[model samples]
Target: MPILVEVSKGLLTQEGEREVFPKIAAALLEAHGLTGNSFMTPNVIGHVSVKPESECFVGGKSQSLAVVEVTVPAITFPNGQVAQKFIGEVTDIIDTYKAKPHPRERTYVVVKHAVDGPWGIGGKAYSNADLGAAIQKAAMA
Candidate 1:
């Protein structure tokens, strides 16, 4: 799982910019009720890119923006209600990082699922069944 966060430079406080990555990861784990799952916790990772405001855009116009794109296994977000709730929670997490109040319209959250069989960890690819077994094994450890 990877949750990519891109923010317009200066949109978040210096401290917030430094810490948002792990915070977002923690929020994801919490949402799934697996905050301490050793395997899953280490697997949730991402990159935070802070672009110059001039490079950030909305509707093809340069603007301050905060975008969170979460890419995970297909089994995640099992239903619409679960997906919507997690999206809202992620939006709220990002909102707290803003240096100044930002328009909610500028914050975007997207979740995409891996098509199975191509999601990789280390050098090996994992199908949905493989991932489920790995997680279950980790939980029992």
Candidate 2:
């Protein structure tokens, strides 16, 4: 189960690189109890990409969101039951970060399950607040 975790921080603040991204990643890995090879294992491949928050927009509106796109191979779960569990586990991690008190701006964190075989699970738009909840919900379903 190669799970790819892609993290992208918005340019909403200058401290995103120095503070936000590392915090999010640390929370995620800790929540999963993944260490050593387990953390790097192909069961889940994680990637982090950061950019200025102003660049992300929707409907002509600038979205000051730091997006963390999580992609996991659908085949890894085989059945919906397993998929749900996996999703839930990841979601919990995101939720923890969302609960943190920080700037008033919106930061989107999304978890996308590659349903089309091994490569189709793309990224989704998520907020720092919704990251964990969304991922948990998707996995439990």
RMSD after Cα superposition, model 1: 1.2
Per-residue alpha-carbon lDDT of candidate 1 for residues 25-116, written as tens digits (9 for 90 to 100): 98788777788987789889889999999998899999889999999888888889877788887778778878987888898988988787
CA lDDT scores, all candidates in order? 0.86, 0.41
TM-score of 2: 0.40
Worst 10 residues of 1 by lDDT: 85-94
Q: What residue runs in model 2 are displaced by over 4 Å at the alpha carbon?
A: 1-15, 36-54, 74-105, 115-141
List, residue by residue over 1-141, the lDDT tens digit for candidate 2. 232333324332344334444444444444343332331232334444554446656457654444455554332334665445544544444444433342323434444555443232235443333444544554455
Superposition error at 135 for model 2 (Å): 21
